[model samples]
Target: FEAGLLETLAPLAGVAVEARVASAPAEKTRKARFDEAMLFTHRGLSGPAILQISSYWREGEPIVAAMAPDHDVFEVLKAAKAANGRQAVHTALSQIVPRRLAENLCAREGVAGNLADLSDKALRRLDQAVNAWTVKPVGSEGYRTAEVTLGGIDTAALDQQTLAVKSVPGLYFIGEAVDVTGWLGGYNFQWAWSSGWAAGQVC
Candidate 1:
């Protein structure tokens, strides 16, 4: 990291700094690997939707797994409507999700009957339920297994131009310790680059 322009600007900006010695690594601790699979009734896992929601994690939180009957039933309904144009959508959906989920959704919507007996009104209601199924997350595995943490130091305390603390000169915070957190993809790495560059310029 170069320190030409940054050193010149540090004093001019009226900033204070602090430098602390980096700590040594701690003794090795036993770690367990968890391999719990996410399960869903209708649409199978391994898609973007499931992957995106998996990123959220916190300390001591249980690992959350989700299941919904809506999509499965919805697909069945859509298939019925297009195939015979007379089959009950809800009945078809039952074959897709678990029996309990199917029964619960039907009972909640007051839909009853075989494929040939469902009315237009019943079909519409069932259709709506399937498309927007709601699921409750049982829990999520705590931070020990989490990929990332959401919050950090307040970036407002540091000067954006030099990555130095306004109250503490020479002191710089970078990487995940900073207030910045990234979305699922490459965005986080970009933040690291930009922040490190700023700090390196001055450090």
Candidate 2:
């Protein structure tokens, strides 16, 4: 586990979506992105995509989610409108995202009624809602449920090649104890093994 899962204050507890999510853009914040599954829990957001971006997410910043990552949402909605103008807006959106989420988003965005009644601008707004939904996370699960902790002994204090403490000759910091952190996959495990091996050679 690590200390990098996000918690949201929104009413999205039971919804899950496969989205391409990105950390908020800012001058000093490193924007992290992931295209994977995300679950809306009673407390906040979780799952692979949320966990990956949490490392780069800063407090008070909004994260962006591309709900229909593989499709052009505007085009889809427009096409749906053309195909069957009587179809409900949210119903058409459900083709892109989960049904619950589609309805929720449509409600939140103040878009409703049949697609035939919607203008090009209205469709664009729905596109933004589907493709670029941004939510500000209240906080994170912290170290308790985190996949791996983020900060550690600064890499500058250690010899990169050997993972040895530059100032303390025999001392070495490896894996999660060092400043190196990988994504949700096996990179962190590999780091632990590789760093330990590098230090083992001469330590």
Candidate 3:
């Protein structure tokens, strides 16, 4: 929160939702799923899920989010419909997600009235909204708030064993200044320490 970065599309601010996010088909690398806590901020989405996905995300490419990752939302909604036919759709959905998020999702899907009144198709759409919410981020906070960065000096320019600049004798580049980057965790820190140690050995 102190970083004040990674602004996303405005909608579900203040809502905390655990999601399984994955890169879109347009992603440059192999698709990997990031399951973590997602927080809706006043400007956009943040927290672990978004930060992890942002490494693979490019502008204009959509990211798929399984909001209800543990539950089959379609089946849940259908079961709710059967168990309590008179309950409102949003009311039933609130049991799965936050109440405000449920209302917003219901409004977005244009679903209302008793669960029994909703068609299977309508319920399915709502299920999609909850389980497969897709959105393209307009922009990110960039390096100002980035935990790590990509696209530094190419790794090929340096000796793999010593992290020394092969063309420039006695010169070395290590850590974030190099192209090596890792997923969200202490992997980046490990790279920093190991690379620095390698260079420290021979530099």
Clashes of each: 13, 8, 1
Best by TM-score: 3
15-118 per-residue lDDT for model 2 (tens digits) = 88888999876855497789999887777778899999988888888999897799898999999999999999999999988888888788877899999999
In order of appearance, the predictions have TM-scores of 0.51, 0.88, 0.91
By summed lDDT, the worst window of 10 consecutive residues in model 2 runs over 1-10
Which candidate's lDDT is highest?
A: 3
lDDT of 3 at 131: 88
What is the full ranking by lDDT, best candidate first? 3, 2, 1
lDDT of each: 0.51, 0.85, 0.86
Residue 163, candidate 3: how far off, in angstroms? 0.4
> Residue-wise lDDT of candidate 3 within 1-203, one digit each (tens)?
22322322245677999899988856456576899998888767888999988888877778889888998888999999899999999999999999988998898788999998899999999989988988777788877889888789999998999998999999999899999889887999999999999999986
Q: Any idea what lDDT model 2 has?
A: 0.85
**Lowest-lDDT window of 10 residues in candidate 3?**
1-10
